[model samples]
Target: MTAGETVRGLLELTRPINVIAASVLTFIGAFVAGGVTTEPFAVAAAVAATGVAVGAGNAINDYFDREIDRINQPERAIPRGAVSPRGALGFSLVLFAGAVVLALTLPVAAIAIAAINLIALVAYTEFFKGLPGLGNALVAYLVGSTFLFGAAAVGNMGPAVMLFVLAAIATLTREIIKDVEDITGDREEGLNTLPIAIGERRALQLAAGLLVVAVIASPVPYVLEYFGSVYLVVVVPADAIMLYAAIESFEDPTAGQSHLKYGMFLASLAFIVGRLAVTVPNAL
Candidate 1:
């Protein structure tokens, strides 16, 4: 393959799009914990660490799912034969180690969080992901933890827990939808994902229900007077997006899976903006 093809293969192995979302979570965590303003250097380092960790996780997931991908995603780096499983695994190891090392330089809390994340990522990819709700819940935790990790870096847990809970539920909603999307390949590959353990239609119903919970919870921060009108404005629309996605997923999980991602992204963005709306004026 040409150099361009090689570069594209590496990018695909990292799942760069997912990495962007994870990195943003790390930033949001720090920002929220510090209450509108956090230590920039430490937050930046944490963001970098998050990006590396997410990339590693994606690469390792692809390494483990190579055979499954041959059916679910033939164009992926490993399944397409552009990158070897061992190569992906080694790259993932390097990325994981780098993220840990960076986090270690921050504080004891950051180091501890990094270690836990590393352990969870490895365990989830290797074993937990094939289980039913357990795997799905673990993934949701990981998503929310990115923000918590940021907050913890500054030695402030604060209201990050609430945000973490919101993120976790939203992520769970999307993950289940994704499982519905991949039910065919997962069943053929003998994976025990929720949809496989239950039934696709049942899984869809559960995902939709869970998403409704998240939507209802979306306005809590505003209603509690923790945020201003800006938060309510943005989050309402974000919640609407999620509700619409949930309804669609119930109707057609495969297609619903695609739209749910956009809804989740918008929700995260709303959180970030809401925080900014409150904090930016205070900072000035």
Candidate 2:
């Protein structure tokens, strides 16, 4: 493949929106850690490095789960022949190496956190991804780590840890909803997703309950006096909207459309609220 083709294939494999989300979380973590020396370039390199790791993990997922993607996501790059398995694997390997190199240039704490993230990503693709609730939990942990990684990059770990926990809870809830969305494809492939193993109604109930918890917990940081009213004003409505979307998704789990919609909505809300919360303390 030519350079442009390879770059395009890598971007397709990573899904740019998700890459942006990962970068945003890293920036949020950094901001919450009190390291935003400049608004534009604040931890930009760290965010880009995290993006590489995130993209690499996504590409590796495509490589290992090509068969599953063929069935569940035929339009994906691998199944659609936009990228071959070998090509995707090569892209993934290079990105993974780049992530490590980027981490090495960051602080000691950032490097350590990035190393852990890289290991977790590999483990997820290699082993944990198929292991029932454990897979969901592991994914949540890694998602939560981005926030701490942001804080670690700037040498401030306190508030970032708190945000990390909140993000983990929200992510786990969303992951359950995702499994419900893909239950049919998973069942067809004999892959044991949460919905298939636990039953759809129960799984929906669990996801809904977790989402409610996360939404309610969304404003606790502000209520606890860790942040000013800016977070309360911004995040309260954001969580309410997310709660509605989660309910809708729980009600209809038949298609990827609803799941994707709800998942994107929930993620957007969380991101907005989390970033705003990080700023509220600073504004005050």
Candidate 3:
């Protein structure tokens, strides 16, 4: 392949869109952490740490899932024969090491969190992906924990837990929807995913129900007076978007899956907006 083609293949392996979205979540987590500890530098480092860690996870996942990708996403770097599995694993290890080193610059709690997450990422990519609901739950936890990881870096975890739960459920909702889209490949690969364990229509119903939970929980911070009218203004609309996506996904799983992808970004924005100007008072 030409150099340009090779570069594009590497970029595809990194899954830029997913990694960048995870980075934004990390940055927002840093913003939330900054409110608690008032450490600007730590927050910045945490964002970098999170981005690197999640990017590593994504690369490694693709490395392990190359065979699956051949069926589901043939254009992926490994499936398309653009990058070798060994090379991808090495690249992921470098990214993982960088993430751990960056986290070590923070407090002990942050370091421990990073270490645990490193192990979990390896496990998820290697083993959990084929386990029925177990793998899906792991992905959701990783997504939600990005926020908590930042909060921990600053030596505080106050109201960020609420955000973590909110994020997890929203992530779970999308993941289930995506599972519906991937059912064919997942079943063929013996992955036993939720959509395979339960019927696609049933999974779609469950995903839509979870979306309702996310929408309902979105306004809790305002209800508890943790945030003001600004949060309500943005979050309400975000919930509406998710609600719309949920309904659509129920009606048409494939199209709904696509909608949920963008809708997830909007939900993330609402999270940033909700906490953009807030002070958590030694939250429980």
Candidate 4:
């Protein structure tokens, strides 16, 4: 394949939506950390590094699970022969290294957070993927790290830290729900996900509880005066939708429709709103 083809393949494999989510979360965290100056280069570098790390994670996930993916996700790039497994592994390693280099130019805290992210991704890909619940926790940790990295970049670890902790809990809960969504396929592939190991009903109950915690925890910073009330108004509906979806999942774990996915999409909108609420003038 030509360079352009390889690049396109990599982009497709990495999934832009995840990159965008990471970028948005990072921006929110950076904005919340109020002491920071607007450093465009620093923001760009951090976002780029995050994108690289996410891409690397995707590529490595595909490489490590090529066998199971061949069975469950035949349309994926690796399974479809668009990119060889070995090539994907090489691409992942290169992107991971690049992320580290980009991170080094930022504050030491940022570099430290980025390094932890890299290590978590590697550990997840290598050891946690097959272990029930552990994979989801690792993924949740890294997911929250995007925002933490932003906080670190700006030298404000106070409010940003709180936001990411909530984010971690939320993402971990959602990850479990996602596993429930994929239980059949995962079981077929002999993967031991939470839903498969813990039984679907109990898993859904756990997911519902987690979603409740996520929604309730999200508004704490705003209530405590770390942010404005505008954020609450904007994000309340999104959080409600998430809670409702979790309730629905708990009510009917056997119903595998597109509603949960849509709920997740709407939930993501809350993050964007949180960012806008904090960044906009007079929002408080």
Q: Pick the candidate with the highest lDDT.
A: 1
Q: In order, what lDDT does every prediction score?
A: 0.83, 0.75, 0.78, 0.75
Candidate 2 stretches greater than 4 Å from native: 1-7, 38-42, 254-284
For model 4, how does the per-residue alpha-carbon lDDT over 113-189 read when each residue is reduced to its tens digit? Answer: 98888888777857897688999888888888787887778777677777777777777777787778777778877
When summed lDDT is taken over every stretch of 10 residues in candidate 2, the lowest stretch is: 256-265
Candidate 1 Cα outliers beyond 4 Å, as residue runs: 35-38, 282-284
TM-score of each: 0.94, 0.87, 0.92, 0.88
* Per-model tally of clashing residue pairs: 0, 0, 0, 0
User: Order of all candidates by TM-score, from best down to worst?
Assistant: 1, 3, 4, 2
> Candidate 2 on 18-42: residue-level lDDT in tens?
7888887888788767787743353
> Candidate 1, overall lDDT?
0.83
Give per-residue lDDT, candidate 4, residue 207.
74
Which pairs clash (backbone N, Cα, C closer than 3 Å) in model 4? Answer: none
Pairs that clash in candidate 1 = none
lDDT tens readout by residue for model 1, 14-118: 989989989998888888776335477788888899999999988898999888899899999988878878888898999999998889877788778888888
Q: Ten-residue segment with the worst summed lDDT in candidate 1? A: 32-41
**Pairs of residues clashing in candidate 3:** none
How far off is model 4, as Cα RMSD?
2.8
Report the candidate with higher TM-score, 1 versus 4.
1
Q: Please report, as a residue range, the 10-residue window in candidate 3 with the lowest summed lDDT.
A: 275-284
